[model samples]
Target chain A: MEQYFVNKVIENNRFVIEDSETFKHVAKVLRHKPGDVIYLVDPEQNLFTATIERITDDKIETSVNKLATPSTELPIDVTIACSLSKKDKIEWITQKSTELGAKKIIFFSSKYSIMTWKKNVIEKKLIRLQEIAKNAAQQSKRRIVPQVVYVNKLTDLVDHKAQSNLVAYEESAKQGEISLLAQTLNQNPNSILCAFGPEGGFAPDEINFLNKSDFLSVGLGPRIMRAETAPMYFLSVLSYKYELTVK
Target chain B: MEQYFVNKVIENNRFVIEDSETFKHVAKVLRHKPGDVIYLVDPEQNLFTATIERITDDKIETSVNKLATPSTELPIDVTIACSLSKKDKIEWITQKSTELGAKKIIFFSSKYSIMTWKKNVIEKKLIRLQEIAKNAAQQSKRRIVPQVVYVNKLTDLVDHKAQSNLVAYEESAKQGEISLLAQTLNQNPNSILCAFGPEGGFAPDEINFLNKSDFLSVGLGPRIMRAETAPMYFLSVLSYKYELTVK
Candidate 1:
């Protein structure tokens, strides 16, 4: 079944999708006619199997067939906060991480980060990343699209509290500190926020600040992963630990 | 410390670096002179710390100071055989998987694979992919560079046997089957071969053939990962299970 993310909230067994992009995708691209069954995901991540009752110039009228349960969402919410890097690599991370079940993604400027987003460019970048996340979520059959947020500094992440907080530091890997991530996750944290450094990695001051702010510095493994690869590895391990190993 | 993969096998506490790529990297790029210390990785995945004694137009002579131990190599050998996909995506997989500790990578034509390698293009493709693996290995400080192989059919995998053979299947994920990969890995297999499908995934006939040929189907997680993402997920999970969690 075709799936879409709609902006409207589901109420009284029906909802109106007035977004022009979705309207064009359903009406023009897919050519979905009245009575075609499509899965619509609401803002709250609730999935509904709806039948298209009618299509209009500005809206899609859908009647709810039933509420559908999707197991694609991860059991725990994971937010990956990474320092901004090259443009294409960040876009790739947004797309791939969404498919791997990250609940939210936050990009911020780090002390060693080479890329910086201007205030005017931030909105455009977020819009592009959000689109990538939405398309990847729909393709992966995820009920909710991970939101992409931009933070101006690493210290801003201190406000994004979670049950478990970790920073992937390469120095920890060098010291052979293993199982901290697994041990932390073993406590059954309902939400996780994992931070990764930029191309050159986190500066000493950034690490000191994160260390003081209660962010547990964890290692991915012995090998040094590229900045873009670390978050994907983290999310994959989360899946294996929570979804695969526990059962 | 500079690292270079030398073609010469170490013997009698010395070896000559003759490969032009390694020669250019050490002699021209880094401008290393006599008495400089360089780490050389041989074909056997052994690391040798050597002092550069002389540099000539043809070769650089180095005397081994001592054998160094690099634990970047995984405990167990893993080979990822993926159905050939888009050119850049396959190249990306080769590089990333190598960094994540894959010992070998095999590319094959699948039933639903859109891209096919002609006989004439195979050698060039292999060379390109081999270069990618080599660079990634050096960047990740891996002891060994993964070998790239090409196969024509799924049945050809029988000759590349391992103690454990598994296929990443999306259907198994949809059915919520878990722990098979971790269980198989727990048996302490010295070598493992994991196969992933192309964008369209494996056809029913291909899955049936794999099922009959001792390849256990394993699911990564609930969400549908892209073809490129599945192999990385497999490698990350392997690292987490074998390297991190057990310790």
Candidate 2:
């Protein structure tokens, strides 16, 4: 079934979706005639099964049949704090990370980051990234679109109230460290923060700062992964260990 | 350090590379001056630390320093047989799957694969994808480039001799089944062949053919993934398990 995110409240037997853009998409683009079935998520985050009752140029109305169960959200909140890359790579990070069930994506311009987003370009760039997140969310049937944020430096990564914080480093792989991913699944931590580096990678001082902040240094594997692809690897492993393996 | 794949036989403390392309890459494109370091692999599949000794338009020569130990390739060779997608997505899969250590990539047209290569165009298309795999191999520093092969039908796939064969199905996800990825570590299968559907996914009869051919049905998760993205997920999970966790 085609799913749409609707900004409305689902009451006893009706959904009131009044967002103009969504109304236009549902009524005009979709060409959803009356009595056609569609899935909608209301403002309260309830997924409602509804049949189109009326189609108009302004608003398309649907009668709520029942609330759908089985939300596709990850069991634990995961916040991937990755160093910013060039525009296309960052967009890829946002899209794939959302599909793998990231709860938040925080970007920091690292000491060795080659690409810089000027202050003037920040707003429009963020809006574009957010659109990528929205489309990924809808495609993956995610209840929430992960938030995208930006930071200027290492110190800008303030301590969040996460149950665990990890930094994936190439050095750890050289040392043959076992994966911390499988071990971090205890009670499915309230929130997990994973940080990745940019092209030139984190400077030695940045690693020192992260070490001081009690971030566990772990290894993904032996072969080197590109900057944009590494964090997605981390999230996939984490998701596999926690979400897929558990009974 | 930059790495390049070289085919040479080290004899009497010297190395000779006969491939004309590699000669041009080293002596021409890289503009090697004597005493520069390059990682080379000999015909015995052994990694060698070679220092540039001579540079010529036809042949660049290097003196062998010592036998370098290559990281043991993944114990289980994994081959991903999937339908080709849009150019970028297919390139993404080829690059990332190489990093994840996939051994071979095969593509076949399905009922709904968006892109199609006709008989006249097959060789050129294969060459293009092979170049992708070669660049990916160089980027990830793999000992060999994964082969890119084209096969046209399910019957062609049934002739493979991998120890394990499987296919990812969204219907399995709908049924709340665990992924075949979870079996990677426990089973320690010697080689794996995994097939993924095209954009519209496998028709019911196609799924039945795979089932009848003894391909295990695996589910990724609740959320749907693009066909190209799905195999990378499988390989990433495999790396997490075998490369990081098991050893």
The ten-residue window of minimal lDDT in model 2 chain A covers A178-187
lDDT of 2 by residue, B1-247 (tens): 6666765456556876667877777777888788998887555556677788887768767787655554746767999988767878777788888887899988887877888777998898788888888777777767778888888875588876478888888889878877465864478888999999997998888999888998888888777777766887888888877887764
lDDT of 1 by residue, A135-195 (tens): 9999888988899999998999998868889999999998888879889988999999999
Candidate 1 lDDT over B1-247, as tens digits, reads 7677877567668888889888888899899999999888877768888799999997999888546454788899999999999999999999899889999999999989999999999999999999999999998889888999999888898788788999999999878788898799889899999999998999998999988999999998888889999999999988988888874
Q: Of the candidates shown, which would achieve the greatest lDDT relative to the real structure?
A: 1
Collision count for each candidate, in order: 0, 0
Writing each residue's lDDT as its tens digit, candidate 2 over A191-216 gives 78888888677888898888788777
Q: Local distance difference test, per candidate?
A: 0.89, 0.79
Predictions' DockQ, in order: 0.82, 0.63
Per-model TM-score (chain A alone): 0.93, 0.93
lDDT score, candidate 2, position B178: 70
Query: For each candidate, what TM-score against the reference?
Result: 0.94, 0.95
Q: Give the B-chain TM-score of model 2.
A: 0.93
